[model samples]
Target: MKTKHPYRLGVDLGGTKIETILLDPEGGSLGRERTATPRDPDGPTEYARIRDRVHTLIEAALGKVPHGHACTIGIGIPGTINAQTGRVQNANTTGLIGHPFQQDLETRLGRPIAMENDANCFTLAEARQGAAKGYDLVFGIILGTGCGGGISINGKIHSGRHLIAGEWGHFSVDPEGARCYCGNRGCVETKISGGGVAQSFFERTGQRLTLEEITEGYRQGDPQCRSAFEQFLDDFGRCLGGLISVLDPDAVVLGGGVSNIDELYTLGVEQVRRYAFHERIQTPILKHQLGDSAGVIGAAWIGK
Candidate 1:
């Protein structure tokens, strides 16, 4: 695609890390930067440090742009900025919950920038060129430590009127399920997310274990792990199945850490079909092709 700007820059601001990418007009990578997300020793994060880090990263990437070439910057945030207030909300990273993140960044850089929720970025990238390519209506799922999702129609992000179109994970399912960061009692996220799985497992067995360890233990015939993992799959089915019923996208692509679980495609998918509204469900649930690069790359494409 021909771009109005020769140099395009994008930032992927996630809960665990912050990454930046610079791309040429043809979408070739020109430069990249990544770092651990800032957090204080007491476990709470500082909004100032995060804001400054984003500023510094953008500045560094801007240095590589040719002097005469025009540049555009876009950000893929873990949460969406409220259109009314320009403040971030529903971020997994709690500290960013109420800050006017985009406004602050624009003030810092002395220019306007494009921004969208990270899951929207994920769906846009996939719908344009990745696993969900050619699908008119694509649903992108990010099953990481926390669950998130996005929607893309005809390769363009379908950010809803309120800019919360694909925030699928926050919808409460069980009235008595695990607690979610969004103050919901039983959000889909609190059931199928990696963190949610771990928390559920801890409650069940009174043991602390990572998602990897729990799955490994299940593979090794550990009774407790098997029980928890089976329930997890069922929960995955209930959640995704319900969403599929609602949107009925042409294709659904999965990304993030939890998407790598082999059983999700087989056993987990079977559950999706069983619970789905259609008697002959045909949604092609797929694995991501661009991997972690999708978010940042999509962000670049979004900015004019």
Candidate 2:
């Protein structure tokens, strides 16, 4: 008799959203659920909210699990995660600081769980099952809140010497540029992140507008909005050009809120090609197909 393979659960915990997905070993999403991330300024309040929201989402996903059996769980956290301690180091989620997130979740679910940075997970998912499926080298980028990146070789994450080989967003692109939330000046994130794009628009037009507003303005051919959007595209292309020079990966996949813009891939490819030192090679910039689910879906394969 053959032993049955266990089911798998993938969870993505972000400051703004929490997503959970159940999947089979073949990378198929069985069931998924998402909810707004609760805001709790106080430590205790935040922890309680996290616990409650996680439970609710997981329970909902569990009800949809296709198999009759339970499975192992994996989580992608949006911060500096210490796998050994399961503690979230520095991150936007202040309430989760120093919390043994993996351990606590394991206790609640009655199973061991794997955890890693969400960007890393997303990269793996894209490389293994999404747009970069056939590539040997894949880089995934998250251009929101701050920039986050992940690298995969041969469909596996290369954590590198310190498990940080994929943190490319923190790479400084301009030392004298705007100050970043990470206390660094002119980091690529400060120039190309979702917040950065909005801030740039505000600076140029003196109007506090949503990204959607900016997009609409661009679509309507507003000069100020067009300028901001075009600048963002150009800068984004320059960044990708630099990445291509360094990693020279087969393809790059983009995720996060900003990726919702239709022109990013097209404009980015043009810019990257223009700025890239290697004039003979053609590098493709692929849009993320999995969207928000990529993190959770990729996390499910952690340690597998």
Candidate 3:
């Protein structure tokens, strides 16, 4: 996007961490910082802390700018803002669920702020300059602490009327599968997310294993890990395949820590084809080129 400001500041409010990134017009990172997201049991107090943390980060970024240069501010969160009530909704960070985050932040900073879903920011970053750069219609999927999806066309986000356009993770593919935080059984997140698979493995194996350990055990031929990993991959295929059948995006870019797994492109895509409706699955399931920086950079652009 062509913007008047030479500097852009972006923040990503994730379930585990809150990060801020400063970018030049050329997309070079100027500065960045990350802090653990406050999860105090007191919801209102924690919300205030998160808001102040974001304010602190943005203030630091603004300090780096020259005296006369202006900058745009954008924030990407795990949830979308409810248009009617103007509050956060459907966020994994439960403290942010019903807060007027945007309004509060803008009031604190005394300026306008562009806020969007972190998944949408990821897709927009990918579609513009990451792995899905050349694609016209891109589906950016996050399989991290949770599963989320976003749509980007020509590098612009399509949030739809209710601002939940690409929310396929909540769609229950299994009625009797597992209960989700949203009170639904067998949602896609319950099947493919790192947290989901780990929880499922714990429930079945009576042991706790990190997602990486499970995949490593799968490679090492451990019986329990193999069984759980195989099931996880199957769920990944089924859920992603169903999404592909519906959206049919020109390209699908995988982000989040779980995307680091090599099998999602090979074994996972193969299963996607098996589950997808079309005989010829020409859609490319590509890895993200930007790594963890996509969401923050996307936030910067979305502010324009």
Candidate 4:
């Protein structure tokens, strides 16, 4: 379908901030703005405040476009929309849970909108113009305070029938491991996410260390840090290798805070090869080129 507007507007509603960007047809950014997400003392009013803040941000961005021109809007949320109930689900921002977010936003904005999981938006951004550009199948993973994954095929997100296609974080990797918030035991997120790494370090050394400190200690050859970091790398390999055995995407792009570690592409890839079924694993696992902007950029492309 042809776009009805000269500008594309993308909004990324993150836990701490709301970011909006305007993009022209050639992918040049026309304007961008960000503001703190509103919070309310009352739990019930927080959602409404957030909604109003987002509306204000969108209106501010729209003011940058020519007066007579229209614009298409897309939004990337931390969670997926429940296809059955048409409500937001699995969002870290608890206020949005079970809310008619899309309907409310559309009613307030007075226009049709495209909404997608942020992970899928990241994948779309990478596949379209970032590290995974030109790849037919791309898997994008975010390793921050939490872990999440998304898939893009032929430049389009494959959200699957249940809208959980690339939710690799919840995959049960260990039946005997700690319970996840999702009511599962030994989920992949519990093993390799930033919080998980810190938890493992604390369990091993009885001293709480942030993931950054643990990584630094490992570099200094601290035995305790080494042990935990090694376990992390091995688990990363095992989980990602097992995933490769299933989908075997053309490329894998890593994003979020944890992807900054340079060793993952080297040591982590080797580990993936060791656990993968293939005799030779040649897939290129790359760092995101668009960085933090990928989420909003991908959200913008949803209008395309």
Candidate 5:
């Protein structure tokens, strides 16, 4: 189990929060922490804040590795990342897109650094050490603020010829349905992500509720909440069905807030079966076992 490299660091950057973890070469977590993401309120200010935050988290995580130990750093950013250039492209955050994040961090931290999309990191984590561990082909889906995904094969991400292999959530399921953050209409994401879930809840119940509140209400057996949740499951299943048809992966792992629903895995699997191609071969839909930590851990796995 010995590796050629020493211990490393993983950082998961989100719009609202960032998590940093110290990871041994064998994928064991030594320490971790979470901090709020910097919000600049404007473009330039936000960029400075994010760079500062990234440096802070990396330093904090690196501090845990003792005074003299050397380590590499990997980051899981939630957006379109130019892997070759380490440039981030997304609408939700500014000052980060196309930033020379890896080089700047390397200079500041005195260690090698790598970067990839957050969902891609999630896929790597699951494929290497979590729910999809034994599988050669794994796809990790994130159904959160915006739907996103990552594809890994044999512990490596299949970033496609265009570096966008696992963008399943953005795939247009209904070109004429609802608008998506990616500037598309009827993307599977727009109908099944956290925002989508809240929007659907509001439409169905004539009440405005955040995604957490709605899920909690459903757990508590509120009839309207339950109904709304069921609808979410239906949409999720349809999306999975489509994905299964295309990827036909050994397993499909679900993460993000919605996956935490008590029986969501069971419900989604059953629903996907209705639309899947392999009646003789049932594919499993599993809830991600790594929780939110997957991104950080997976980030440490960049270029592994």
Candidate 6:
């Protein structure tokens, strides 16, 4: 029999795209949709364009459900909601900052909803059903265009007291390193992110190379590429090893484009062992099973 009520709808509000998915009670996808996030040149308010787009996406997702079934909405944003003001804060999408996003979205949808940072959604998904399933403490890391992280304890997100518990990307790895947009020097993101690796290669070789090119060159034994790749591994080891020292998670599941590099599981794991406080690093560092779908699926679970 079909689930009578409390269907789940998830929306991943990413920097460039908005994706929505409908999930049945069994956690199977009923429908999914994706669209470019709307940009408004004439709108007076920044959040208005994106807000309208999200509303449209939600409506479209709901339409895919069986008759008489309505889904509870859960949204994953690139930033966190401020506990004090209930506004979006620390989003790279500047327009979303300071906007009363949750309230505005709730009003437009005419229902209660759940919202969380995208990284948290990724972590939750992994812990609940993806690579980290059955793990008590899971740490999920995203090393894509930028770096970010999230933590899940017993299948539930641990947002922490200040709501920034798993924000490992901004942690300063080098005090004298490059200046970050977050106004910090040598953040973990500035060293291990795909963009960061590319930037580092350019600075050293003065040849602009995409992350794919760098990895390919590394595979082909290019010295400059090898140097960049090794640097990334070192940074990854130190940063992640440091985090493991503190959190000691059951598993560390990696997502994002950079995670595709097989070296992370091999050489990167060795480096982590070297730097980790423990004599023997038994923690398993695994790749994400759900790939890009983790965020959206996790969002649905949040609503559930």
TM-score (all chains, Cα) for each model: 0.93, 0.87, 0.93, 0.96, 0.87, 0.95
Decide which is better by TM-score, 3 or 6.
Answer: 6
Tell me the whole-model lDDT of each prediction, alpha carbons only: 0.89, 0.80, 0.90, 0.90, 0.80, 0.89
lDDT tens digits, residue span 257-292, model 6? 998999999999999999999999899999999999
Q: In candidate 5, what are the lDDT values of residues 1-304, reduced to their tens digit?
A: 3456678788898888888888776657898888899886756678767878899887777777765555777888877666566567763566576677666777787666777888999988988888898988888998887788889998898887667789888899887777777788888888888888788677667899987887788889999888877777787778888888988998888889877766666776777887777775477677898988889888887832
- Which residue window of length 10 is worst by lDDT in model 4? 1-10
Candidate achieving the largest TM-score: 4
Q: What is the TM-score (0 to 1) of candidate 2?
A: 0.87
Which residue pairs come into collision in candidate 2? none
**How do the residues 106-211 of candidate 1 rate in per-residue lDDT, one tens digit apiece?**
9989999988999898888888879998999999999988888999998788888899998999999999987787887999988988999999999888999988
Query: What is the overall TM-score of model 1 with all chains considered together?
Result: 0.93
For residues 52-72, what per-residue lDDT tens digits would candidate 3 score against the true structure?
888888898899977777788
Q: What local lDDT score does residue 261 receive in model 5, on the 0 to 100 scale? A: 69
Residue lDDT tens for model 2, 139-208:
8998776789999999888877666787887778888878887788877887888788788777767899
What is the Cα-based TM-score of model 4?
A: 0.96
Residue pairs clashing in model 3 are: none
lDDT of 4 by residue, 80-126 (tens): 99999989999888788889898898888788888899999999999
Residue 202, model 5: lDDT of 74
Q: For residue 213, what is the lDDT in candidate 2?
A: 78
